[model samples]
Target chain A: MPTIDILLPGFGLDTDQGYPAFCGVFLVRGPDAAGQPRNILVDAAHVGRRPFLWTALADHGLSADDIDTVVLTHAHWDHVQNIDLFPGATLVVHPDERRYAHTPHANDWATPAWTGLLLEQLPVREVGDGEEIIPGVEVLGLPGHSPGSIGLVVHTEAGRATITGDALHFAYVATTGRNPLVFWDADQAARSIGRILDVSDVIYPGHDRPFRLTADGGIDYLAPFALTVTGAGPDTPGLRFADSSARPSWVMPGIQEQRALYEKNADDSARRISRVPRVVRPAAAPRAAGPGSG
Target chain B: MPTIDILLPGFGLDTDQGYPAFCGVFLVRGPDAAGQPRNILVDAAHVGRRPFLWTALADHGLSADDIDTVVLTHAHWDHVQNIDLFPGATLVVHPDERRYAHTPHANDWATPAWTGLLLEQLPVREVGDGEEIIPGVEVLGLPGHSPGSIGLVVHTEAGRATITGDALHFAYVATTGRNPLVFWDADQAARSIGRILDVSDVIYPGHDRPFRLTADGGIDYLAPFALTVTGAGPDTPGLRFADSSARPSWVMPGIQEQRALYEKNADDSARRISRVPRVVRPAAAPRAAGPGSG
Candidate 1:
């Protein structure tokens, strides 16, 4: 049987002030078709996490070339910006995702129109639901957050380990039975979460730590959250980590949320008072993309 | 005389692991043509910063309706995602930016092609470089970061204050004399930075704090950095901030950087080692578009 190692844990933290736009990067290692050991990276994180991703790989005595496959759960800028880092690997994505990137709607602010440019140039293989990337690691259809969002069902030694992208962004979405950041159908998103719950023993979310369903249907985290800051600054003194016990709430507006909010705010609306033109401060707070997050 | 207040500051923090997709949102309050009090928001930050933007405005006892005009520094999704929030405000963008957003290049990943869809629907008044949105608030041409990138030159009571979106993203770009994230022209970017230095007593960047030039040609930050985080979590133990002594470093890969790195890595190189299906670890880190400012 193959095994799974969570290279990093995703934190569930979003704010109204800004969006800490970080997702999970997973690495799955198992035997190839020929029974040879193979390494498959689930997602290549955006540019911000490259240094940390490299370090995470290094800790496991690995490098980008050691892997032979890169599976992208979706094609959001934050989820799949590092494909160039793995030039030798064959890229795996859903065909629907590839098609959607070509004509993404303006409301889909997360998908850059130019993304198709990169996707077109890369050597890619389209994988759909139930397709096996390798033995014991099968692709699962988990759309919602994106049109072609997919998940991975890895037959790990302990049990079934599931990795779902934004379809199951955080633990709350799973427990609440509602995916908050839906870009597609909300009902579809709910069904997708059902798919995740049906197959998952331990679930890894797109922007959160690994967790499992408790005996009484509660949540139990698999690991402690940890992060390291790279560039150091002053205006901020005594930098530390966030509190762990609290619920991880990602304050992002999905398509449905946006539509609802827009409809509400635009109702014969009149907005008020305000600016010295002071932009995002701390040179990073607004662009916080803090240590690591959603 | 009407004055300005920097409700927030932009950060100069970007990492390879993630792209803290954020920019500056400036509120310019002054008298209208009839000498009545008016507020013009320079840039409407993306969805990520809606909470902070709202708080920042409320600090002055203002709301979205108070904004009469919106000056888009450029059309990157990060700079203009929240335009829907200000329905009454007439948007001010360069005609060239408006045109370019119609068909952005694939390399310009920061620009979502659907951007044109949003730009087209807004109540827009195309402003060119050297055009005045209001008294003493002028738009300056500072292309290079994007095809139609522009800057703002505001005549404040203190002196001449300038807001350069990504043309002068950080202090290093100004001092180092080179923009690390150029999508248009390298030489043009250099010239744009020169334009910023020529007519400013103080500078507000897209993703860094406000700073001024000292007598000895050194940079001095005008204020201490402050940030408030919402929806705290655990895995992180200490809740502190960054060091002000260290220089701000945004580790994003520009088109040039990507090409250079791609070339260097893809030259008959075989890279190695790695994985489990573990994606980006944080709910926010992968999507770390953290707190106020860029």
Candidate 2:
């Protein structure tokens, strides 16, 4: 059995202001080659909040060095910034993705300077479609949002859970079959989405809550409430959740936002807090018997 | 003074049935560091037609080994396929482009297997925006089609001629301000086009026939007639020239189409010519007083 912990169930709340709602890191704790428990991290989150990654790991009674492998979905800047935190871990990326990260199109989001500097210090391994990194965890080539974006499918006790980094930005996209706003090839993205739907019953999107396929073939959001955008404008939409008036459980104070606020108003004693990254305890604990349950 | 030869004026005629009408290679004959005559090649056409490149070079009394340097506009497969032909030449590419060539997105037109193999053997030098690769030949960061797509601005005796590889696919795109159907970022492409229009007086596009700018800021096609796609459908259009009903000079028997034709009708005697790359002579010799002429 394996445990998938949402280290930071990233932004989807109206209360989350003045913070970059980019990405979250997930810790996949499973048995290694020798059946000993090993922790693998997916995505590193934006570079500005590296401390939050350390805090999130600490909450699970783990340390940065505990991560044996870092399976990157893609090399977009927001997802690869905190890779330095796991210096000893082996870095695994899709072959095309590794190439894309090194030589990305000008329009695509990539941090060549940062990625280049990190690769110099770490050993990187390339994985392709259907290749297994750990037992029951196979890599899926999901190209559309990127040339080399990949998804990890893990066979858990609950069911098969697929961790799709940006491949499916919002859980709603899976249900509607509409892709995210940004992508490399729209036709290919649409095809990849179809492939994802056929393979997995449970999905953890790059952003938003985890979702499960109901017996009647309907998508069920794990969170009590899910955010919905009202207007067609590209600007940030006013946040409102489905099925509830109260905020969702995953909302937490952003580390960089808090630091900036403290610097801006030094005299505000109430805002002064520890400078370390702290685990954000959700208001309502995630359902124990949900999709990601081991 | 330097000469700019349209080694292969890319497809526009309807006769090019089965060929990929994607790119053309331009030979910029200019003086190098010590005022010695140097032949610099901008972009190498698609890999499928390697013999055509050899024949084109031979037509100009030059050979593959005669090339002094190769300045890549970007790393798209169509533009970099024949890089191996210039083994001894110095390979200069935009730093971002060099990265892009290595790690291109899945949707982008990149032959990673071929590019990777070639890179392993050739040493590539990085060039940045506004940097001069040769005397009077400066590199401009024209990002849109690809992250590291660059344009070469050559100060010739005729005028300032900019070789925009795929950045300005059609002269109409520059005139109408509409981007090509294929692009990485639409906004960035528009900005790059504007920069090109401002800096260069004469332009040589990647796919279409070369066009010069008039005193009234309108584009003037160098050819007697040009091809225009009518109707909204994406399929191939009927060919017609702007000022004349007759076909313009540079149409040739497409190699891929000929191969396909030969395969379909094995007994066709006309199609079964010697399997060697032949020089495609223009119906009318190019003007000696144009932008590329020395």
Candidate DockQ values, in order, are: 0.12, 0.01
Q: Model 1 shows how many backbone clashes?
A: 110
Candidate 2 - CAPRI tier? incorrect
How far in Å is the alpha carbon of A55 misplaced in model 2?
45
Q: What is the C-alpha lDDT of each candidate?
A: 0.68, 0.60
Candidate 1, which segments miss by more than 4 Å at Cα?
A1-9, A13-17, A25-158, A164-199, A211-228, A233-235, A238-244, A248-294, B228-294
lDDT string, candidate 2, B1-294, tens digits: 666887766533221111233476889987877888999888876533454676788999998778878888877656765575666677888766554443333223232312332332335688888998778889988886666688999887768888998788767667755455333555677788898899887888876668897888677977543222211112212222132223232212232242243234433222221211111111254567978778
Score residue A275 of candidate 2 by CA lDDT: 17
Give the 10-residue window scoring lowest on summed lDDT in candidate 1 chain A. Answer: A272-281
Counting clashing residue pairs in each candidate, in order, gives 110, 8
Using TM-score as the measure, which candidate wins?
1
Please give the lDDT score at residue B127 for candidate 1.
Answer: 81
